[model samples]
Target: MQSCRNCPCTSRSRARTATARTQRSSRSCVTSTRAGSSYRWTILAAGVVAQASFSAILLGLPAIAPQIRHGYGLTLTQVGVVLAALNVGLFVTLLPWGIVADRIGERAVLATGLTGCAAALVVAGFTSSFGGLVAALAAAGALGGGTQSASGRAVMSWFGPEERGLALGIRQTAVPLGGAIAAGALPALSAHISLRAAFFGLAAGCVAAAAIGTALLRSETTKADEHEDASPPLRNPRVWLLCAAGTFYVTTQISLIGFLVLFLHDDRGVSTAASAGVLAGTQVLGGAARIVVGRWSDRIRARIVPLRQLALALAVAAGASALLVHASLWLLVPALAVAGTLGLSWNGLSFTAAAEAAGRRRSGAAIGLQQTFLSGGGIVAPIAFAAIVHATSWRLGFALAAASPLFGYALLSPLAERRS
Candidate 1:
């Protein structure tokens, strides 16, 4: 198990290759496989494949929640527990997975985790009890949690800072793209056949993805790669700030993801399907926004003035959108879009900034630590929203969501300043 301390990774020159054209393009034609490297892009492909599969399993469960309920006669809370367990799995492993990614090279961890997730998904398909489902999803979560960050690190290593954001954004879209497939297509499969059958099919997808990922994600040294050098960590402050910013961003994000449908039903007087559709549409739009923001951030990476200003603007818009929920249900869609776009758009830039801020070699750890903050928000957000709703209403809940970005805006200013 070679640590980042011992392992030779992509060089520093790769980190700062931020030319004007390449700044926004994550994978430059001139920079394939780094000088002597072999199959770095293959690792990224593996990550995407694994991520897409995990996306299917993660959302597939919820898509067939009703069928699951009918078959087992379970409670909504029981179904919710399955979903919650996924996070619990992820939360518990966040730190260790990061450490592992840093230790063994991101590829080893990625391949191993994907394989483990496939096994979990296989076992989950056979379980009839709610407890079994929880265990299975939790297993999947723990093994699968690192996929997102590790993939980001892999891509960021290849691309210069200018293009890293857009590159990562394209990669990050897999989350929603996977979810949309599950939401839109898996439902029919689940309903048309059986819940157990759906799980079984998804488990098979995991196996195929695992094989793909293992083949793609690997260390360059094995293939005798050449690359430039970069700085090491002082435990970069910009990394921590990005983590903090992510905390606030996801706190708001998870709150809406978990409860927006409920809010639509109770407050806006929409049917469940309609509400779900609205939320789904918002996610799709937000997914696009992520790509846009990533590319936009890449274009302006050299200019600290615009980066800070744009981040601040996102916060302000999010805050204003949160308040607009009381105005009209139609208004809620755009508000959610603004909130989603702002919250998720940071997917590429924040991580790109971390990679740039700490040098490219340690991007895995930077992204990993930042993910800890993001996962921490997942823990706090739903509970907070539940408390807020219990005390008052989801309206107040969203208002709380709006306020978070203001603080994030403040923290990010210093990073943009430092970059300047």
Candidate 2:
């Protein structure tokens, strides 16, 4: 193996490439040593940037949903279809990408997946018809989904367990950064340029991410990091419980945060900018939650207590918000903001719980199963809400949102007892 002394602060991607060449020649499994490696930290920074790009694809289109609806003369179902297209990309591709990440190592999978997102987002930007849009979104989602699982795995490998929450929290910050950026900026971008241009901008950003990812994504010391694993059966009870809890947490999250702006505009009759501000603010609030919750998870022995407290708090917030659906247009800002704050912030904690529940050896698959459950909610909830909006109104739809957390709480409550 080439000494770290030679490259100085060489990029992990280059390191990986060099290691692979060395292994082929020597028929050995030695990974690049981390001696004198300042560049490893740069990889983490790049991972953060890549995550932001991935998040933009998920949230950018929704920011311009109103314009798209008007331009296309779309019905509620069609609007749902557009939103669903993005989530569908996320849902269907998440586990498959996880499997791939396990097989190839994170760097190769991350580079390929990001490039796919760039191409697909560009296609989505130009597509005119619904079918064309769907195809592009799915492709973007397939590529984009790989970032989360693979990135999380990469961070885990890069940093040891104690630094994990901080490292992972930095990675998780992409969720809010992407959402806040799209929510605040895309509408303005759409006003001056076309929505397509805004998408092109994101496409450009993702391309930049891909280039960095290609250079940074190499490291495969552990056997688990070298090969992808198939979908294994759930042998542990904690995995199943986490799956159930994660479903509820994500269901409440995706349904609310995903459509927070619409809920403000349609249900409360807020202005578009105000709605965007609310969306942006909600992301900021949730971003803080990821850091706070993640750090808290690190200090505490039992993450379940904090998570359960958060879940129960969310249930109360959601229930109260559900009641306030018809109070007045003015009440929604605080209601939705608080609801979003508690609703979506549980992810870091839950993911931390995944590491604890399944142990590090099986953590990737455990996380994949939880993510699959989370994404499954993305498929079902919006469709149901669309039906509700068509038949009645959003107030009833808001009332119905409580069901998932109630279910999530049922599963998550048990975690406190079983926490290691």
Candidate 3:
């Protein structure tokens, strides 16, 4: 037995086992080491840039929807289909991207996705026909959905529990900020340089973001960073509740954003540029509200409480805006601003909660699931809102938008009680 232990074959086998153990330990240590505060903020910055790129391109079209319709000689419903196509692409790919993020990490996913978006946007810019435009936008959306889960998982994985709410909140602000940028620039660009130039500009932004993300985004080598757990995200009750609530919440936001400019122009005689400006203001205010509400949740050490409050506030604000649907411009603008703040502010809170409930290993998949439902709402709401306006009136459409948050609030209340 002693001679066998000393044999050359036995020695080689032992060396191989020892080498494997050392490699695993090195990887485990890499993953477990807490990232510095600055590094976490860097992750936030990268995520914001990536998210903003996706939002700017996707939201840019809506800001210039009027120009697209005029150039293509399409009706309102056809315009809605154009907008929905992008989200339809997102809905189709979000889950698969999340699963890939979990397996491959965020760095490759974000860079590749943003780069794909840049390419798709460039193609979209050159397309002459409506069918070509829809196909290109849908392709952009399918690729861009990669950023949603990858960027979200970055914040959730990098920050500790205590600081995640605020971090995620700051991250969430990028959506509205991107929309604000589009509102401020895209419509005017389309007017002056041609719609193609506006699209090229969006593509340029995505290219810049892709470069930044590739340079800065790091893979999580930590077990907490990339390890798979036995439990699937679909099995989490809290995740499902949050997803349902997000569906309703996002429906209201998309409805307002999708139609706000047109509503102001058609109903109040506001110019296209001026109406876009009002929508921009709503987006800016909504972005600020997300930051404030996120910090509020962090201080309270509770997620659902703030979520409940925001949903209620959104419902009330939406109702008030509906009442002002045709009121004085002075009344309507402020009301929509208030509605936007309330309607768009709850996303970070819900996202943070879902991440917590999902645990570190599953954050990517969980966020992906929630986003799928949110994108589903995005896919449906624009067409539905356009139909309602065509059938009954803009008043009915706005009223229905207002009521959406109440249903979100109702779905969330029980979850809050359970968490409490």
Q: Model 2, range 1-420, lDDT digits (tens) per residue?
A: 467556656667778889989876544332222222455567678777888888876765667777777766787777777777766777777777766776677777777888888888888788888788878887787677778777766665555455567666667777787888888888888888887887788888788887888877766354433453323526777778887777777767766776777767776687777888888888888888888887876677557788777877887777777888878757856887888888768887777677546554445566666777776776677777777768987766666775667777777765675644
Each prediction's Cα lDDT score?
A: 0.64, 0.72, 0.85
Give the winner by TM-score: 1 or 2: 2
Q: Which candidate do you rate higher for lDDT, 2 or 3?
A: 3
Question: Model 1's lDDT to the true fold?
Answer: 0.64
Name the candidate, 1 or 3, with the larger TM-score value. 3
Task: Put down candidate 1 lDDT per residue, 222-275, tens digits, no spaces.
Answer: 111224333433356666777787677677666655565556665678765565
Cα lDDT of model 3 by residue, 1-420, tens digit: 999999999999999999999997876555443443468788899999889889886665778888888988888888888989889989999988888888898988998998998899999999999899999999999998999999999888777766788889989888888888988899988988898988898889888988998888885545554453537789988899899989999998888887888778777888999988888888888889888988998888889878988887888888888888878899989998888777779988888898788877778898889989989999999999998888898888989998898888888877774543
Which stretch of 10 consecutive residues in model 2 shows the poorest summed lDDT? Answer: 27-36
CA displacement after TM-score superposition, residue 201 of candidate 3 (Å):
1.0
For model 3, the stretches where C-alpha displacement exceeds 4 angstroms are 1-35, 221-230, 417-420
Q: Each candidate's root-mean-square deviation in Å?
A: 9.7, 8.9, 6.9
Candidate 2: segments with Cα more than 4 A from true spot: 1-41, 220-234, 328-330, 359-362, 417-420
